[model samples]
Every structure is written in C-alpha cells, then in structure tokens.
Target: MRFPSKKTWILLGLSIVVILISVSPLLKDGFPKNHDSELYMVWLSEFDEGIRDGQFLPRWVPNVWVGYGSPLFNFNQPLFFYLAEMFHLIGFSLVLSVKLTLILATCLAYLFMFVLSKQFFGRHAALLASSIYIMMPYHIGLMYERGAFSEYLAMAFAPLLFFVFYRLGQKISYKYFFWGSITVALLLLSHNISTLFYIPAVFLMVVLFSKKILNII
Candidate 1:
C-alpha cells in the first residue's frame, strides 16, 4: 500500500493556502486591482503598443521607459510577451492575459520548489523550503506589480535549476548536464539580475555540498 509522506501532506496544505492568497487578488473586476493602478496602466499601454506594432518582444516601449539610451534591454523576458501575445490574439483582456501568465508561473514555482527541495533534503525540508520561497519577500513585493513579471517567473526557474543540478550530480548523466545548462540559460534570459543574484549563492551552496567541486580543476 502506498502512503503519503509527511512532506506531501505539508505541501498539500501549503498549496491550499497559496491558492487562497492568489485567488483573493482576483476577487475584483480586473488585474492589478486599484492598489496597483499605475502599474497596470503602464503594462496595458505597452500591450496596446505591442499589438499595434505587432512585435512579439516588447521593443523600446515608451511607457516602460527605463532602458532608454542604454544597450541593456527591458528586464522582462520574451516568454511573457509570447504568452501575452497569444492571449491577445484570442481576444483576452491585456490585464487578464498578463495575470493569467503570472498566476501560472507563480504556481509552477511553488510546485517546482517543493520537488527540487525534496531532491536534496527530505520531504520535511522540502516543504519548509518551499513555504519560505512562496512567502519570499521579493515575490510579495513584486508579484502584483506591473513590469516585474520576468523576475517573478525567473524566481520559479531557480528552484527547478537546482533540482536538475542535484539530479545530474546523483546520476552523472550528460543529458542532465545539457538540460541543466538550458535551464541556467533560460534563467539568465528571464532576468539577468536574478541570475546574477542567484548564481553566486547557488555556486557557494554547490561548492559546500558537492564533493566533486574539489575533484574539478
């Protein structure tokens, strides 16, 4: 007979709590709510412009006016744009389109964090780690705000990246290596700043835990 692990039960409980928090924001008529009115207005205007010019990437948006005169691109990733474009084509509200993507990304992040954390630590550690991640200050700060979707999505990728690395080290497979590299690249693409922040911390953790770190030249 199969029995659910304590970790599984903890995750199930946390999942319910997170769902409630996420749905609470949707009790209103639209995305961003009145609390983040300016944030939504900015993204909505950019969505209109992107549709007018027919670009999948948010190129030189006037309202998201931070990257002007700099070679540095919009911190936002193309995946969100791609997802939003498809929703726009389907006649969904721009606000709803972005919200939907954000919600999915957020949920995936939680799920991945649990799975990944469990790979290294047991179920108890995994559930606790995942709970911390979902309640992270950065996520809470930027989750509903506009133009920060890339960071939010990339946040989820970080756990998956670690999980893949942990599995690769366990099995020592070339295919895992390839997939791990791809995950890292995607993280960089989504949010270079986050990659920058995560890379050092991840590297330090890896060095401390990975015996192979000393085996490599």
Candidate 2:
C-alpha cells in the first residue's frame, strides 16, 4: 500500500483544521437558529421512532402534520436523516446528531474535494481548493443559516462523482465503474434537486469523453 507522503499529511491536517474552524459554530450549546433546524429535528425524532418500531426505512413519519401523519420521507430525501439517526442511535441527542451530521458533511466535502482536486492538481492546490470549497459562504450558510442538511450532504458527493467519472473517462475499469455507480446512488439519495442539477453536468462529461468510453467498450 502506498501511503501519503509527509507533505500530503500536512496538507490534510491543514484541511482538517480549516473544516474544524468553519464548523465551530455548531459546537455551541444549542442548535443555531435556522430555518429548517427545528423541522429536521422533528423529522429525526420521527425517524428514530420509526426505526425503533421496526420500520427500517420509514416513509410515513407518524407524528408529522399534527399527528395526521405525512409521507415526508417518501417524498423528501432521507439520506441526511438516516445519517443523523445513526448518530442518535449511538447515544447523541437529536439536535446534536443533526449538528454532527452537518459537521460530518463538512468534513466529507473537504476530503472529497481534496481527493478530486489532487487527482488533477498537486497536493498544495488540492488543499487550497478544498479549503475554499468548505469555506464558501453558501456552503457554510447551508448548515448555520438554512439547516439544509440533505443539500449539504449532497455537496460532499458532487466532487466524488466528478472524480469517479473523470477516471472512467480516462480508462474504464471495474473498480471505477463500481465506485461511480455507488456515488451516483448516494447522490440521488442525498438530494433530489441537487441530483437533477448534476445530471446535466454528468451528461456533459460523458459526452465530452464519449470517444474514450466507446474505445473501452
């Protein structure tokens, strides 16, 4: 196994530091006031109940819409809530779980962006690109301002999907194909709107690299 070089580790450490600083606001005593934070907390609570009641992937959260119930999960993306549920099951409070999920998404966004950037650019440039990606106003605001957890998680998958497709464009292999498919699935589950937006870009990439794809087939 080829381990990262010393400089690569340093760059990764720096990236982690940047991610930590950017998410420090989440470390506050309570959830930050945001548009959707309460809504996510409610959803997560319902999801937890569903899980305990043996509904692995709950579509109808029983407590939503004044107990009349809403098929919220059936229509909305559940990936983010699923992740928060994992944290919740592990003993964290629902609010903390939600915050942790956002923090995790921030870390994933940096790591994925770094790996994708490093594939084309050097480690230093990758560090810069990832730092910028994690610190983008909209990226930060998604968690701290809007509490758009699903969309935020989707952002983490975007670069990973691009990296996978870019590799397949160069050379098709079972490894790349498997990862590409998984990335697409994760992105689709993460956010519907983001997936719709990304489809065009992915198609463009496929078109640009059609010759290579054809040669492989």
Q: Highest lDDT: which candidate?
A: 2
The regions of model 1 sitting more than 4 angstroms off are: 1-14, 33-76, 145-147, 214-217
lDDT of each: 0.69, 0.88
Backbone clashes in model 1: 0
The TM-score of predicted model 1 comes to 0.73
Clashing pairs in 2: none
| lDDT tens digits by residue: candidate 1, 64-158 | 45545321136544555566656766787777776676767777788889898777688778767776787777675567544477777788788
In the range 1-217, model 2's lDDT, one tens digit per residue, is 9999998688768876898899888888998898998998888998899899999899888776777998988888889988999999999999889888988888899989989999879878988999999999998888888888899999999999988887887786899999999998999889989999987898788767667666766
